[model samples]
Target: MTYFPAADRYREMIYRRAGRSGLKLPAISLGLWHNFGDSRPADRQRAIVRRAFDLGVTHFDLANNYGPPPGSAETNFGAILGTDLKHHRDELVISSKAGYTMWDGPYGDWGSRKYLVASLDQSLRRMGLDYVDVFYHHRPDPETPLEETMTALDAIVRSGKALYVGISNYRSEQAAQAADLLRELGTPLLIHQPSYSMLNRWIEHDRLLDTLEAAGAGCIAFSPLQQGLLTDRYLTGIPEDSRIRTSVFLDESALDNQTLARLHTLDDIAKRRGQSLAQMALAWALRDERMTSLIIGASSVEQLENNVAALGRLGFDQSELDEIDATVLDL
Candidate 1:
């Protein structure tokens, strides 16, 4: 059977401008960080991407090091693009990043012009793309000069390998500096990708949002569900198949009884709002207008739909906000 998109794809989802850039990203963008890897079924991955597009998720985020083996996510997404979405290329925002350890040896990692340039070249080849809609430096490199990293991003844009450039995992200080350098070079930072959720509030204390607002850049949060902990996946204890049990980022120590209690408290608030814990988490993460979008990783089509349903009720009154803060912050 032939694949055709939902007729009213744009009817429900919302799009917001990325910083001051001309681009507008869907409020709930799909991320290919986990499920697009080689170990996942190809048919399942294809279904998720197609369903996401049908829901008005125009942006798909990727990194060069996304897969278990590295680079396989881009390879898989490229196959999807080549088949189902070839004609809709211009309707989507495809992004890829570098600055992680992609291969062996010194030149294979970090923020040198050599590594960034070479990594993106390999990324384009793997994705079978002439250029990505946005290319990001995945993280800050203390060893590399800010000027060199920003210059490399500028050059990538100039060469047409990417239309816009962004930075991720940067603190307010680092992000401010990158924004300045990119501005001086005439490109300007387009957006910032940060880890933000009710659990992780470093960006709030770090004031990264204020910095991006000042720099005329946008912010998109990843892990808003805190790697599935903020959802019902662990309310009754970790499921046998739950990846949260094995993640290096969220060790067992992080899921103590206190944390579980907090999850239940938060879920109670979500139930009042007529939403699942996952949906509430997504809505809460975007409460601030400065947050331009969110990158959500889904393991199944049902999960994707449930997450996107967050868009239906993104509002929270002062009382709801205070109640949520009291619960998550108390733990």
Candidate 2:
């Protein structure tokens, strides 16, 4: 294929308000959490990104610790930017984060001033960008002072290193505190990235959704497929090429009898809805207006296209919703 984007790429996807911010993100955003590593063919990765843009997916999410070898994802993405997406930079919303281990001991990671500042610098260098659209404190750091972390983020925004600030994996209480601190520094929180899916409903119980919406912060859900557990790929058996078969994050033990039974039940419901399990899962995640977008990571362009098709089948009748609740809400 010659790689020309869709004929009407700009009109293919819908944009939603990213909280109270002036920013608008596509209903689905591409995430470099996996598959954009140095080991993969750079040409293929570039093609995936180009295809996404052509399909109206402008928001691309990244993190400092995302590659199999660490930082290689950003380095590979940097190469892609210099090659394919360079001229179309203004149309893209690129984001990166720090707060996990990226280098050697002590100053290498977490929410410390030294860590956040240095990590953003390295991320910028790796992505070949003067500034990221959104910069995130990847997680809450209990040991580090909240003020120090917010200060580094403030400096990053003030110095034009990043246009907006966000946080990921914070509870309702922690998020409220962080938002208040950032407001004092003149950077109101913009978004919160959380791992939400049909199977994983921690945020619902914790009231984090209400908290973020109350604070006027938007949310983008990560791992909305529940690491593929909510997908049809596991309905039969775990394929060796599947993430569960290879991932340290998703182990073989995760596919116990009970888990498989639950998946089958949900699969049946998805079939009744005329969609795949993965599609149903994504639709469920995006059903909430508080959900700005579903941050999806795809290993191939086909996966990306398949996931985006869910946008067409987003509606759920009351009976379908009730049935889904009965099937997946065991906790």
Candidate 3:
């Protein structure tokens, strides 16, 4: 069957400028970190991508080693692009990252020029892309010079392999340093990807958000649901098919008595606000105007639609925020 996108795809989604960059990303971007690999059915992955686009999600985030087998997610996404989204390429903001353990060799990982360049080339080949809209360094490399990594990213943009550059999992000081180097190279840092959610608020405490604001860079929060902990799926108890039960990223031990109690409190607050726990979690992440988008992963179209619906109710008054702070922050 041919895939025809929804005619009014852009009507409902809210777009925000990525920092001072001219690029505007949807408030919710789709991430291919999970369920878009060989382990999942190809039809299911395609459906999720199609549904996300139909809901006006223009940005698709990926990394060099996102799959269990490594690189399979990009290959799968490439197939979807070739078949379903090839014509709509101009409407998309595709991103991929390097700096993690992608291959096994000594030069296979980290922020070295050799590694970043080779990894991105492999990523482009796997995703069948001429150039990704945003390419990121997946993490900071302590051994490698920051200048080396930022220079590599600048070279990638100058060579037309990536339209813009970003960093992920970098601390406040590191992000500031990278932003300064990129500015010197005439390729200002566009965004930063960080793990942020009710359960995980390191960005607020560490002042990374302040750094990005000072640098004029946007922020996209990953793991805004804390690997499903913020969702209702864990309200009663962990389901058999939950990520905590199956994936290493989340652990059953994280559902401690105190955390579970806090989750219930948050759930109650969500209900009062006319939203599901998951929807409230997303809305909370987007409550800060400094946050450009939230990167969400969906296994099914229904899940994608439900998550996108979070956009409908993004407001949080002072009282609601105070309650959330008492529940999540005070915990």
Candidate 4:
């Protein structure tokens, strides 16, 4: 069957400019970190991609080592693009990162010029795209010279392999340094990807948000749901098939009695606000104007639809905000 995107795809989505860049990203972006892999049915993955686009999600984020086997997610997303989204290429903001262990060799990982360049090439090949909208160095490398990594990213833009360059998982100091180097190379940093949620507020405590604002770099929060902990799925107890039980990223012990109690309290607040826990969490992550977007992963199309609907009720008065701060912060 042919995939025809919704005619009013852009109507509902709110797009924000990515820092000082000319690019704009949808408030909610889809991430291929979890479900879009070989382990999942191709049809199901394709449906999620199609449904996300229909709901006005134009940014699709990926990393070379996203899949359990590494590279499988990009390959699967590539197949979906060739089959269903090839024509809409111009309408999409596709991003891929390199830095984590990908291939086994020494050149397969880290922030070295050799690793970053080779990994992005492999990523482009896997995604079947001539270039990605944003290419990122997955993390800061302590051993490699910062200049080498930033130069590689600048070269990637110059070589037409990526439209813009970004960094992920970098601390405030490291991000500031990287931004300075990219500026010297005449390629200003476009954005920064970080793990931020109500449960994990390191960015706030570490002052990374202020650093990004100072650097004029946009921020897109990944794991905004804290790997599903902020959702209602764990209101009573962990499901047998939840990520905590199934994936290494989250542990069952993370849902301690204290955390569970907080979840219940937050759930009550969400109910009073006329939003689900997940929706409230998503809204909370975007409450800051500094947040350019929030990257969300979904296992099912229905779940994706429900999550996207969070945009419907993003408003919150001082009392609601005060209650959230008291619950999550005081905890």
Candidate 5:
């Protein structure tokens, strides 16, 4: 059977202007950080991508080193793009990053001009696209000069390989510096991807959000569920097939007594609001005007559907907020 995206899908999602840019991103975006890798079945990957589109998730985030074998997620995404979504190219916001480890030796990783430019080219070839909607620096590279990294991003946009540029996992100082450089080059930074959730409130105290807003940049928070810790999936015990059980990124030992107890208090609040903890967590992440989108990953279509359902309501009230502030674990 062939899959065509639902015509009313756009009506279900609200697209917000990212900073001062002419682009508008959906409130919820899908990420290919997990499950859409080479290790996963191709049909399953295709179904997830199709389902996301069917649900009005127009933005798909990817990185150079996402797959277990590295570079395979983009390869898989490219296959899907070439097969089912070729004609709908203009309707999607496809993004890729090149910061962490990808290849080998010197040129395989980091934010240097050689690595950044070459990585985007390789990403384009792998994704079978002439250009990507957004290109990100993945992370700040202390070893590489900030100017060099910005220069490479400028060149990427100038070469017509990427339409816009973003940065991820950058501290407040680094984000300001990158914004300064990109502004000087006339490509002014558009968005910043940071890991922010109720449990991971480092951004709230770090002043990164304030800096981005002051610079007129948008922010899309990743891991908004804190790798599922914010959900009720672990209220009892670690599930056998959870990310903590199967992946290196999340660990089972994270489910300490204190963590579980804190989750119970938060879960109680969510239950009162007729929503799940995950939904409440996502809603909390998007409480601010600067938070344009909540970037989430799912192992199956069901999880994606459930997570994005958070947009159905603003689940928190004043008491819920006070309870959340009191119950959130101090990390």
Candidate 6:
């Protein structure tokens, strides 16, 4: 089928600058972490990607180790880009990260310049692109010198392999250090990607946004739905098709009785506000203006629509916020 994006995409999605950078990203971005693997149907993946672009979602986030087989997500996404989105390359913001273990050998993993460079080359080949709009370090490497990782990212930008560089899962102090090093190299940290949601709030405790704001970098949150714990799908119990049952990332014990009670109470609150728990979770994550965007994963077009529709009601009354603060998990 011939794919033509909707003309009103720009009008539908609101864009925000990444820190003080000249680039702007849509408020909601799509993640290819779980659903773009080779195990999933190709047509369904294409449908989800196409629908996301039609709804004004211009950013698609990926990583070298996203798929079950490690590199299949980038391969699958590349296929879509070559066919459906071939001419729309300039209209999209594509990002991929390296740092996780893609192969067994020591050189195949971590933030060493050798790994970062080779991994991105493989990624560009997989995506069939000359360069990604944004390239990320994926996660902080424990053993690698901070200077080595930041310089690798800077070198990537200079080589025209990535337009901007970012870091993920970094704490406040680590982010600040990376920002300082990148600044010295003249490629300021563009953004930070971290886990944030009603249930998972480590970024708040670390004041990561404060670090990014101080560094003039933007922030994008991942796992805003808390691995399906914040959605109505788990209110009664885990469905057969739920990630808890089908995937290894989430443990089945996470849906224990106490957690189910918390989920129900949260659902009640969302219903009073005329939104589903998933929608409320997303809106809650984006309530702070400092949160530049969120990356959500969807297995179907309907799920993508439900997640993107959250933008229609991003604001929360003080009382609603207070109620949320009082009711949410202490974590």
- TM-scores, all models, native as reference: 0.98, 0.97, 0.99, 0.98, 0.97, 0.98
Clashes of each: 0, 0, 0, 0, 0, 0
Prediction 5 global C-alpha lDDT: 0.89
lDDT: which candidate is best?
A: 3
Of 2 and 6, the candidate ahead on TM-score is: 6
Reference-based TM-score, model 2: 0.97
- For model 6, how does the per-residue alpha-carbon lDDT over 20-109 read when each residue is reduced to its tens digit? 999999999999999999999999999999999999999999999988679999999999999999999999999999988998888899
Cand. 6 TM to true fold = 0.98
* Greater-TM-score candidate between 3 and 5: 3
Q: lDDT ranking from best to worst?
A: 3, 1, 4, 6, 2, 5
In candidate 1, stretches whose alpha carbon ends up further than 4 angstroms from where it belongs are none
What are the per-residue Cα lDDT tens digits for candidate 1 across 30-69?
9999899999999999999999999999999999999876
Give me the runs in candidate 3 sitting further than 4 Å from their true place.
Answer: none
Model 1 error, position 318 (Å): 0.6
Better of 2 and 4 by lDDT: 4
Q: Write the per-residue lDDT of candidate 5 for residues 1-331, one digit (tens) a residue.
A: 6668888888888687888788899989999988788789999999999989988999999988888678899999999999888889999999999999888799888899999988999999999999999999999998999999999999999999999999999999899999999999999899999999888888988898799988889999899998989988888887798889987878977888888889999899888887889988888888887788989988789988988888888645788788799888552
User: Model 1 clash pairs?
Assistant: none
C-alpha lDDT score of every prediction, in listed order = 0.93, 0.90, 0.94, 0.93, 0.89, 0.92
Task: Give the Cα error of residue 39 in candidate 5, in Å.
Answer: 1.5
Candidate 3 weakest lDDT stretch, 10 residues: 322-331
lDDT tens readout by residue for model 2, 20-47: 9999999999999879887788777987
Q: Which residue pairs show collisions in model 5?
A: none
lDDT of 3 by residue, 1-331 (tens): 9999999999999999888889999999999998887899999999999989999999999999987579999999999999999999999999999988987889999899999999999999998999999999999998998999999999999999999999999999999999999999999999999999988989988899899999999999999999989888988888999999999888989999989999999999999999999999999999988999999999889989999999999999999998999987765
Model 5 misplacement above 4 A: 329-331
